[model samples]
Target chain A: MNLLPTEEQQQIVDMVRGFLAASAPLERLRPDKFGQIGNPDAALWPKMAELGILGLGVPEEGGGLGLSAVEEALTYIEFGRALVSVGVLGATLGAHLAARTMPDIAAAIMAGTSAVGLATPRGAVAGDDGIFSGEFHLIEANEADFIVLLTSDAIALFRREEFTGQSERLSMDSHMRLMRAALESGKPLSWSSVKDGIDHARANLLIAAYATGVAEAALAGAVDYAKVREQFGKPIGSFQAIKHKCADMAIAAEVASCQVSFASVILSKNSDESRFHALASRIVAVDAALKNGATGIQVHGAIGFTAEVEAHLFVKRAHLIDFIGGDQRVQKGQFIGADAVI
Target chain B: MNLDYTAEDEIFRAEAREWLDANIPREVRPPDGPGMREFDLGWQRKQFEGGWAGVSWPVEYGGRGLSLTHQLIWYEEYAKAGGPNAELLFVGCNHAAPTIMARGTEKQKSYHLPKILSGEVAWCQGFSEPNNGSDLGGLKCRAEIVGDELVVNGSKIWTSSAHLADWQELLVRTDPAAPKHKGISWLICDMQTPGIELRPILIMTAPGHHHFNQVFYTDVRIPLSNVVGEVNDGWNVAMSTLGFERGTAGMLENIRYGAVVERLVDMARQRLGASALENDDIGQRLAQLRAEVTAVRAMTYRIASRAAIAPPGSEASLARAFFSQLQQRIRRIALDIIGPDSIELPEDDPWIRPYLRTYSNTIAAGTSEIQRNIIGERVLGLPR
Candidate 1:
């Protein structure tokens, strides 16, 4: 029942971390020649596909890395550390969505040939006549060939052409592009039916794993800056004020990280408690990321506030990941009748 | 990444649940004092007689010697069964007994181990002095070696159960000329020794709760053999038991914390009426408490997963500080939920006592500040 990553799992995390560092460093978040924050990494799709990053959790028999949600979750933490595009999540979950029914599309999504954008469905409804209607908020989806939309209890994949309208809007988080689509379902939408409560838990826990990574990264950055940053002729870390904040950041990150492991393991086991854990883990991880990201900025004094420093990127990504399916506030209500007895 | 329990672990869990269901005391633990002590010891004695006590102790010491996972299961079941808190046995079983097992002489182990495991004796800690509570290394209680025995003088305050304890794990400054931290000696002191006097202190808690005392020692004598380790090296011996204690402390209590949060949510829902879910203050706070408590549970399991629940390193401070603060937060949230109902302690309401008692969460064991220092200097390699 050990929650620590195994040696093999450590290697996988290292491999993903190494891949992100080399291919897409934090420097990429820097505004480019046109002052644009991020450009579509069209080439990364095929490369990640070759590396099996897209379908890591899909069974090997179904053309994936032959891992479980635990491995996939660990990989997403590295993704969070790198501040990689949220579309990576889109592509990953998209592969999972397509695996059972559209095996061909699943292979394409996994192969990285098809870019799948993860979207949040608002006011979404599926009618008895087999029509799905919702205004979808697309996340990092401009370059996506396919968009994945989540209804309350199930998931559905849609072609970019299937949307009635698509538009780009400036978002609070520049690292991940936000778009909106008014979905007017044309044909009978095939809902790749998941387990009754699995869709929310699966997606929420993955998001939580990513948020945990951001929290950890924020703590690391704060600690490093505290050690080197000087104030009153001494490292700021020498002051109990800054040191205690760093300690608190460490605690928040620890609880958040452990919660991710917990939710991932329970989800992997298909436990009845997975939904409850999913909601709980998301709240803890998101809070950790938000708190650590803010405090990490404060720990750096002036430089942390600047866009050039990587500290604020965590704050941005934390919010973006937090609201991928739904913001944590709405998610909290789900626990109203949840297992107070158990 | 694996949380799969063996088939045997499940069976053990079922066994524990079944046993607890059959044997749990019908009465709630008293708030404090003799009744509380008697209730705790009697329950422990029952567990020991039933071969369920000392789940983490090695079999040679009359413990079940179950794996760490088994200890986790046993405690989880114990909490679920509403078992009385082991308030009287903490210093004995968790601190002194483990320290003895690690650093005690054969004779020390031979006598105290069975007595502690059997609930025949209660042990209280005498480490925190009147002014040296958090700065434990700078404690001023003095002990001088004299002809095959040690003479002790000085007072230890905030000693839980000291009034009822049969013996105490005492830390006194042996080599006053040496450095503050280096001069301390840890001794096993008989509570019945001459010149030992206890003054019970009424804490800011519910009425009738007198769980703390200040023990004054004037020329109290103890045989030198009672020292768990080398006389002057007691600082190391005293510190030896904290790792397991800090990392795993309040584990079973965390289950109670979860139940408390659940009960809070129930209370909030009833209080807030139909708009409870939309009520931002109480509703959201209760929801977050549930998540935070669940996170603590995960953190506990992660700590337990350490090989055989092995002594954690400095990282234990991180877990300790988090759990303690969360306890405070959960308690505070209850006060908010209870509103004016909390103005007076009701006989049947469970929230008020814990809410008041949790004030010590960040203060006791180690203050949150000291925990930060440990984290800053020891964990993050920051300068003092």
Candidate 2:
């Protein structure tokens, strides 16, 4: 069981990294001052579609790259590193959901003619019969025609206006703007059970992969800052305290990335243990992301608290992704067995 | 990345599983002392006789010469079958033999490798002097060039099993005038040499049992030919084989640690009943430990998978540090699970022993601090 990326996988990572590097550089997150974020990388849908990133997991017959979850995960990590809008994730999952059962919706989403925003139910409970009317937390909701509604058991798609509500003007992450939407009388345009719909296992794998990127990005940011940002007549990195913290960050990110990659490979095989690995990947990756994010900001000193550095962006993105994707506690309950096996 | 097993890999795994199922010693290893040494050596000899010794060593050195993947399979199978611990033989087979193979002269290899693989002799490391633990280069152990041999002086501490060891992979200050790091020499010092003394130091975990000794050399003599590499160049010679231990330990024992977590889970279940995981504190900690150990396995696998593409690096330190810390965590969890059973009626509690032993995990090999230094400087490329 090799964990090394195949040559083709390497090429895919390079391609995604290259696109993200050019499109949504970390410099964009380096705003002038506190409370001011740089212009969020506009979800340039057409370009993403042209690059076949929006519908990465859908099959060729569904007008996608026909790639497995491994490729999709590798690509999503780049998006995470870029702190790209969760709209990309919403669109990808939305398109994947459509590809499984609804070709027309898939085509529209994949072609960039239509977009999907992810709506995580926030006490926005829907009945078992699929009727919805409550407060829903929204991600990339303002720019989307469709919304992928996340219930505990399933994901339902609806027109954005169908869930009419006021936006939370000040969200933690401005790019993936967190909002509260009140849905009044909504029936799903399309929906599926989380198990069969978007394949929850694959979903967790992708999200974990994204978080790993954030964790890694934080490590890199901290290390880079430690290298040049001097204190006490030497680079702060030379200090054991800073050095050890950075080292721990590196280890955390490394462990997170390894598990993410492993879970992706397991999902690729359609293993019975896929859910197990996915849950584990999520737990470890999120832990790393959060830990590294906090540590990264600390390494940047006072500037990290300000938007003068991109440290805050990674942590925000990590939290935002984690909010939509299951948190560690939720996943732990689902997949944690007393008699654990790997 | 593909985790699909090749047909050959499956066959290899099956072979390992079958052999280990039959041959893994039924007797538990003795805790320490001569009997413990004999038990360990006997087990190694059994594996050697069964054609399973040195699973990754080359054929020329009397090993199976299995691929890294296959060696991992063997390790997993061995651990799964509840194989006896490879304690006394550890330094000989994993550390000394590999070093001899890589850096030793033809005579050294022919003299030592066969006996090590055949489990006829035990080896111990003497790099750490009383003064030089983490700072191994700052060692004060001295060796003077005499007629045809070197006269060794000073003492070595934490030389595990020096009282029992046949030979030692010793490091001495061969060129005192040279720099601290530059003047060292790596020698295969015979433990039976005259003027050498061993004072077994009782360790904390096992009462009345000792694996460590403080060895004094008033004027121990060692043959010049016993030096593995050039005098004053032994630091490099010694260093060449370090990452190997880290890599091998992480890969081979990760599966066992995973099982250890499972055992902890089972212990938690027995104590808390079916809803063991429903208990907030105990349950969450166990679950988190599982995740951490799984990560270690994944990280270990990543290192192995990348071995073919790139040489192993400071990444090994990350795994080492993580794994060592995990050991402490798991043991802590195990203690919490056992609770008063550990202190109430003194039974041979498996978990408590390891728990006490694990306190030394972060301290041994290199301190967690040293590992971080390596990671920050070497892997992360931070300033020295």
Best by DockQ: 2
Cα lDDT tens digits for candidate 2, B227-262: 997879999988887887777655766778888988
Report, to 2 decimal places, the DockQ of model 1.
Answer: 0.68
Compared with the true structure, all predictions reach lDDT values of 0.82, 0.81
Quality of candidate 2 docking, DockQ? 0.69
lDDT tens digits by residue: candidate 2, A154-242? 66778788888657656677655666887876887777664562376676777788899899999999999999998889999999999
Q: What overall lDDT, based on C-alpha atoms, would model 2 receive against the true structure?
A: 0.81
Model 2 regions lying over 4 Å from their true place: A32-39, A123-135, A151-153, A161-169, A182-198, B206-208, B273-279
What does chain B score (TM) in every candidate? 0.97, 0.97
> Which model scores highest in lDDT?
1
Name the weakest run of 10 consecutive residues (lDDT summed) in model 1 chain B: B273-282
The two-chain DockQ for each candidate, comma-separated, is: 0.68, 0.69
